[model samples]
Target chain A: MNSIVPDSSFTARSIAENVQSGEWSAVEVLEGYLSQITQHESEINAFNTVLEEEARATARETDKDIAAGKTLGPLAGVPVALKDNLCTNGIRTTAGSRILENWKPPYDATVVQRLSAAGATVIGKTNMDEFAMGSSTENSAFGPTRNPHDLSCVPGGSSGGSAAAVAAGFAPISIGSDTGGSIRQPASLCGVVGVKPTYGSVSRFGLLAFASSLDQIGPFANTVRDAAIVHEVIGGHDPKDSTSISEPFPSFLDDLERGVEGLKVGIISELMGGIDGISPEVIQKTREAASVLSENGALIEEVSIPASLYCLSAYYLIAPAEASSNLSRYDGVRYGLRVSGETLAEMNINTRTEGFGDEVKRRIMLGTYALSAGYFDAYYGKALKVRRLLAENFDEVYSKYDVLLSPTSPCTAFKLGERTADPMTMYVNDVCTIPSNLVGHPAISVPFGSGNDGMPIGVQVLAPPMQEALMYRVASTLESAEK
Target chain B: MTEPISEKEVSHVAHLARLRLSHEELQLFTKQLGAVLEHAKDVEALQLDGVEPMSHPLPMENVTRKDEVHKMLDRDEILDQAPVTEDGRFQVPQILGEQP
Candidate 1:
């Protein structure tokens, strides 16, 4: 039966195209997603707030636009999920934290506005680590988002819910912020295509700040072409975000069929073996992907970025230092939760102590200590220097290779409570993806094969800044070869 | 490994960050933070004499725009989200004096 609204296995491109051709009503597409959500959302815990009424209204509007013979944007009937950090006007925008649990933003984030303008109906706000801090969704103040593949295991995070939503068929496309692999890591675990575009490629105006210098908004989708489409629609210059790159965004979808013939791909050596916590199966799958590209006429080689060894160490210092500064705005006087006290300072202290989770507090303290008077030079300053050296190392490689390859995560999804007790153990998950964020380059994780545990393994393809088309060509190749 | 940071130091940093931790939290953080910091110490081993420190990934020049008035978020809506509001302004506890 060719059911128009059957269970699972839907793509954003198909939905938009079908709606445009009057083959499927926008209502039918939304209901297909809603039916999936109704059946599985409670079990997956992927969303903190499902915008059912709002999504229905938008879907109806999309149908109206099509009936009126109006030209719609690229994503006419697509359902999108947003990481809780990105604001939605008048909707609760909790970054999966206790503090902002009931907080509603008065305005939409720039990304939200752009998605709406592109005719995508935002179905829900997905759960995430409290302030997007953890590698697993365990740091979420609500509850952890479980992997759709294995209910007992984690979907990688802080963008866990965004990935899980797409994996669980709640949404075909989703938006998440990647500070240090938040998008790609979870996408790898959930067997979806996740992208972290060039640092300033997407506007960050509405994304709740985690580490402003490192945070970049990206998408998770069922295919590389869909990811490229979503990326193009949401990317480009915005007057609202001062840091947004003013350059014109290239048509990423056009490059999908361009293919990776005669392209140079480097397997990042430090991430492949030199770093700790990488599993044999993950490495094997990544190597197999490299050969697959080689078979498809791509040149493959082993290249070393020595500074990648220190990226995790340096990132902890640099990201936390920036976070400490960004998260200070959560005082009781403004939006969100506030606990009372006699004095103003005491009120501020009490508010933060009760509002934030243990992981967030740990980061705040770590950041404060690093930026404090005595330890500033030794920790934060030195970390900044290491960041530069790592960027320089990657740049040296970029001069030779069109893109770099590595595992998106160290291993497949660990059991829910496996690494929650130890922050250091969980931090190792970002070892491969952090280097790209540090260098402000674009990267994507393509689901290549399965690990020994039967969980999906994702092979990451990274390119130099503004080279997403080149990166997507390789990712598209890997995705097609998987079948 | 021995603790690189003491409980007292953790409390001090916590105070600076405006987070009041429980006695148990202080104990846990001191041990956990010490190990994380010890790992971060690897950066100190790098010979970074001439490498210029990079704070932002892109070489961003100061972005200036003509000071023009634009539509802003409604003042009432902003106030409505505040935890404490009075007369359309965010209300806070006293700044200078002790508890009245």
Candidate 2:
């Protein structure tokens, strides 16, 4: 059995091919991954819940199917990890918060259902920022998921665990939710490919709503082609989730090797030279990527999005405001942990106090205040207006450019506990990403550079709503060229 | 121009939001919130003279759907999540001046 390593480049396709040809047994694959989790999970702190017996049984069944000449799906017998937020039947689906620590969903999320139907064996649930609220995994109720690249450093969250798992080879690929770049940011930091599908393309049913309008489920893989393969399986309509569109799904795998020839790539000048805290190395890498695209026959053009300056400000208001409402469902009334006191108010207070982490409480308070009667017009409503303007600006740019390019994050993974005390500083980490969420467009984060600290930094590719295949083609070309 | 918001207003909002704060938290959040209001102040300063406020991204009109019978969750499952419940209703302490 091969041990899982940080740079284990064998993808789901390669592993499946070996397993199907009887070259590698499904039992061996599961056992190998199990051994990997046992060896590395302590150092990485990636998984919050591990399903060892369940995975072993599934692997046995897969072996039986192969013996019987069963028609195996593309990812049959392949081990994949999942972010904790995606609900699994009878499994603890904690969204990295104490409130739902013991809450087991009665049904599987659409994505989970699809993955199972596609013959992928789910190994475990991974850690994330509490309620997918923070940019770092430090906010997880269980504990922070450490970066695989540097043990002492943080894993970018709220899909940090998923990214870290894929990077560290705990699993070949994992599904992660991207709301405000949760998937891609971590992918960039961990040197993996994380793609956030266009809004409303994937079903959000059973994804514990953290900003319903912006939340999307995507795959994190070591290779862009692997990510595309996983995305195609999980991308489609579901009657269970009304937000999911009944549109024809694109053949992401079929378009994996498509180059960006004659494509118009917009280099957002403001994102490149605009921010103060961004490092020179990030800018250099971005410029280099732009040049490569230009060299590859892509028409690179400088684009300015002036309203992007207010994206962070707008995000804070809108995300918190939506979070406050979404989190209201967690009040000791629904399936989760509950604390009690003599009075009703005291009971509610005690339950929330013990159940919620500091960051979740802080955001809830901020959101509640922002959406309060007198303050709604001033904060939430105004933010909505700015969000519109930003979306319109992106629309105008996309009318000309095929896709917009910028650094995925301002910087790479910082040391663990670096920004725990300073919330404002932490919020700035999502400056480039928050715009995509606000505009309800799709974006992907692919590794482009090694930061000054030698950690991975990602380049973000933004496309207009439902233009994910276009973004995927450009990203794949860049991904191929880098290799 | 943004009108000055009082600390009392913040306190009231906090109450509605169910936040239990120390004296220090209140003071700190107030000052920080006040400083951040400048952006909103600037946004309010915009000449959105004829622009109607947008609620959603898509230009959706009045959407009405037919009501259909769906299987509601079982009483046991519904009650399974409550911190405390009695007689199929969520339980809370009876308030002297409040209605259930």
> What is the TM-score of each predicted model, taking all chains together?
0.98, 0.94
Index of the highest-TM-score prediction:
1
Candidate 2 local lDDT, A1-483, one digit each (tens):
122345445789888887787778888988988887888888888999989999999899999988888867778888999999999988889999888888888778989989988878999999999999888899998989988888878879889999999888889999999878899889998889998888777888879899887788999998887887888888888878766777786677676667888999999987887867777888888888998889889999889998788777778888888988888776576568768666666656777868888778777877887888777877788888887788778888988999999998888888888988767778878888888887678889888868778888888898887777888888987887677
Cα lDDT computed for each candidate against the true fold: 0.91, 0.82
How far in Å is the alpha carbon of A178 misplaced in model 1? Answer: 0.4
Root-mean-square deviation of candidate 1:
2.6
Q: Score the docking of each candidate (DockQ).
A: 0.75, 0.41
Clashing pairs in 1: none
Q: Which candidate has the top score in DockQ?
A: 1
Please list the residue runs of candidate 2 whose C-alpha ends up more than 4 Å from where it truly belongs after superposition.
A1-5, B1-7, B31-45, B52-54, B58-78, B85-92, B95-100
Please give the range of 10 consecutive residues that has the lowest summed lDDT in model 2 chain A.
A1-10
CAPRI-style quality class for the chain A–B interface of candidate 2:
acceptable
For residue A272, give model 1's deviation from the true position in Å: 1.6
What is candidate 1's lDDT per residue for A385-438, written digit by digit as tens?
Answer: 998988889889989999999999999988999998888999989998998888
